[model samples]
Target: MDIEIAFGQPRPWTETVAWGPYRARHADLFEFVMPGVARYTLEDRSRVTVTPEDGADEAPIGEMLVATVLPSLIWARGDVVLHASAIARPGQNAGLMFVGASGSGKSSRLQRAVGRNARVIADDSARVYLQDGELLASGLPGGMFIRTHDAADSRTLVSVPPEQQLKALPVTSMLILGNDDSPVRRLTGVEALASLLRHRHRPRILRLLGTEADFIGPLGDIAARLRIAVVGVRAWMP
Candidate 1:
């Protein structure tokens, strides 16, 4: 585990963004306060404290920990995390990834592939890194958060039973989902990295943490080597 979580008392902090139950700030330290739920304080984005609110349930808090807090820690650890989804071919260590704006069918296409026997790698975010000059991805801890009804029929749709998480897999291909006029098209290195940057998780936070250089270094390296392409119903074909 790259991050450690523990129960602790909530500390007072300035509000950065207050919307509904979520109040957040990132000054000396990053903190998220969920009224009547949980207050999370990430110390240097390394150690996380989960302070449960009165009468709060564990499921939602756990979800936030896995979905939001962990991703922040991943970035703090100098890794590149993206708002993407992926799946690996069954019985193989290699994986294929799909990236695009929300509602661009990243999840939908991945679900289609999952129905055809691809193992779920990630649902909404992909934790990526470079290992021995190869790009790799690991499943984030959580079930595949599906927004469409068709995904309900996927074989892997069992609500991420706590023990059924996947391990890291070598990412062999990437697809930039869009409504291009071609079926599929290869992306130049510049185009590929641009797409990656647009999907980077907490890109703004990376800059505030002064880690943008670290994040882009590996991203460029990965983009330079991967078989990147753009795919749509009429997308550019490689």
Candidate 2:
């Protein structure tokens, strides 16, 4: 089997790896090679060769593979994968990203912002890339998901099925939703760095790769170039 993703340019694959109901291909969509012993082969720019290992059931593997590979594919095409939610609008050069623990109101705030006319660049994950030294945020193929009860009340909001809602957004402005009722405020220097560190992706993975320092350098650069904030909500809006 084969899968193709067209992001302005065509990426084709021909290797087949069956996992659960999904089969993944080693197409040109990947910029980095698969880490570890997960076998894969690329054929006809459209198919992948997949051999399931013992205990490696299909469903989890399929989900893990996509999550691991999609970002590299997106980055290969000159996009940055941010672990946050993003929103933007006309006249704004960059967007805002909200990141926090699950049920932290990140999506709810973004929904509110969208209702206020902010264009959603991405709901859960934001794709950011630097062009001519300027960071720009772009939308992913998904949208934010709210609860069914909230969904009915937010008919005017741009939403999608719960399963398809995103949890990451491109990094423009990093907002950490505080549990308290304090007002929102901008953070810089150490405060900003601490906040970003709290939300870094796969912290253990980076440590194992010995890339923690390398990762921090770039994150610091991003923090310096973009706005970072922590906002407090009075209640569980969602």
Candidate 3:
């Protein structure tokens, strides 16, 4: 769906970006207006409106559009959002999602896979859901966001098509990346559920907005349907 993001006159409010009650106005309604980023209004469960920060260039607006606004949009659609990177084998339609905490090498590992002929699916955020008993991964239009320093070594990430977003890649497996040197290990249902919940993205706005009730059921279903495993560098060793 094409979302229209029209610039609006600034709302007269304190300017702050801290993730706290005071920094955000209309907290009770789950709406946020970041000073130098963008303003987000969760109109309802399925609709959101965004206005770019005043005087911002295309890059910042685009960044916030993907990192902040897009996730909110995906959440509104009732899909389980993940703080992870995903990749698919070359010429294949299915992919595996690799999730981990910040600094856990999720993106780096996925880039390594890209060097070995895997296609970059989603770099940092993914919208995953079960469709007709098959798990799938969906991404937005922006290319993978590679740190400036890592650009020298990134293969597919070096030149991602801005308009090319993976519509859907059936998810055949899930991996939890870590720093450990151990080989891959399958996680039990309970473990996978806990891991999924831990890495899933739900903005702080969901707190006072009282939308957790809508997500609990779908998350449980995702955990039950997908097989999850924990892996480390060894799993990617040649």
Top candidate when judged by lDDT against the true structure: 1
Model 3 stretches astray by more than 4 angstroms: 9-30, 44-49, 150-158, 161-165
Question: Candidate 3, residues 116-180: lDDT per residue as tens digits?
Answer: 66766677788888877788887752466665455553323344543334666888778887787
lDDT of 3 at 107: 56
Superior by lDDT: candidate 2 or candidate 3:
3
TM for every model, in the order presented, reads 0.78, 0.57, 0.78
Compared with the true structure, the alpha-carbon lDDT of candidate 3 equals 0.65
- When summed lDDT is taken over every stretch of 10 residues in candidate 2, the lowest stretch is 1-10
What would the per-residue lDDT of candidate 1 be over residues 185-233, giving only the tens digit for each residue?
Answer: 7886788888788888766556555567776678888788778887774
Model 3 alpha-carbon miss at residue 156, Å: 13
Residues 39-82, candidate 2: write the lDDT tens digits.
34333445334544455555544443444444433433333456
Listing every candidate in turn, what is its Cα RMSD in Å to the true structure after a full C-alpha superposition? 4.7, 9.1, 4.6
Q: What does the lDDT read for residue 18 in candidate 2?
A: 42
Full candidate order by TM-score, most accurate first: 3, 1, 2
Better of 1 and 2 by lDDT: 1
